[model samples]
Target: MADIDLDNMTLDELKKLQKSVNKAVDGYQDKQRKEALAAADAAAREKGFTLSELTGGQVKKTKAVSPPKYRHPENPEQTWTGRGRQPDWMKDALENGQSKEEFLIV
Candidate 1:
């Protein structure tokens, strides 16, 4: 990635670089798919079909997503929620080396 110093490259060079790499390709594909799905949903709504109705009884139930727990980068302290009162145990754990990824997985 160090070879990709964009600031030093010419427009022609930049175009060449982009062509050779994915360059946010995954995000772009996801965005396009989302847009297409949104358009389909809107069309269905206009046709007086409820979102559930259009799914032909194949809708998947989804729960509200809970926020990820936060832990200190270098410590073991873990926080189930990043909001509200901070706990002393969490602070101590964070100081000990329990990272955010470890907290999330646990």
Candidate 2:
């Protein structure tokens, strides 16, 4: 590979280079994942069991979405399921002496 003088590159040239690098990285990662999956599948077949049978068929478990329990006072579109960390709006409201019940969806 030829040495590239990144310090001397114009903004457009740098941006183009960055785009190319990102594309190349994505392609490399995809190829690696495919190769790994193929190897796992082959190994499973050799063992007389499919990969999905040993791994519960899911690459990742999906969490069931909880229904929103709280809504923003000013914006009905903004809501929280009353799980995880409190959102900034909820925090600010609580700091200003607003109770959690005030934001209840019901």
Highest TM-score model number: 2
Question: What's model 2's overall lDDT?
Answer: 0.93
lDDT per residue (tens digit) for residues 1-106 in model 1: 3665789989999898787666578779879978877787788899998666988967555677666476544564544576677677666667888654555534
Q: What lDDT tens digits, residue by residue, belong to model 2 across residues 28-91?
A: 9989988998898899999999888989986553579999999998999999999999999999
What is candidate 2's TM-score against the reference?
0.54
**Best lDDT among the predictions, by candidate number:** 2
Evaluate model 1: give its lDDT: 0.70
lDDT of 2 at 12: 100
How many backbone clashes are present in model 2? 0
Q: lDDT scores for all predictions?
A: 0.70, 0.93
Clashing pairs in 1: 75-94, 75-97, 75-98, 76-93, 76-94, 76-97, 76-98, 77-93, 77-94
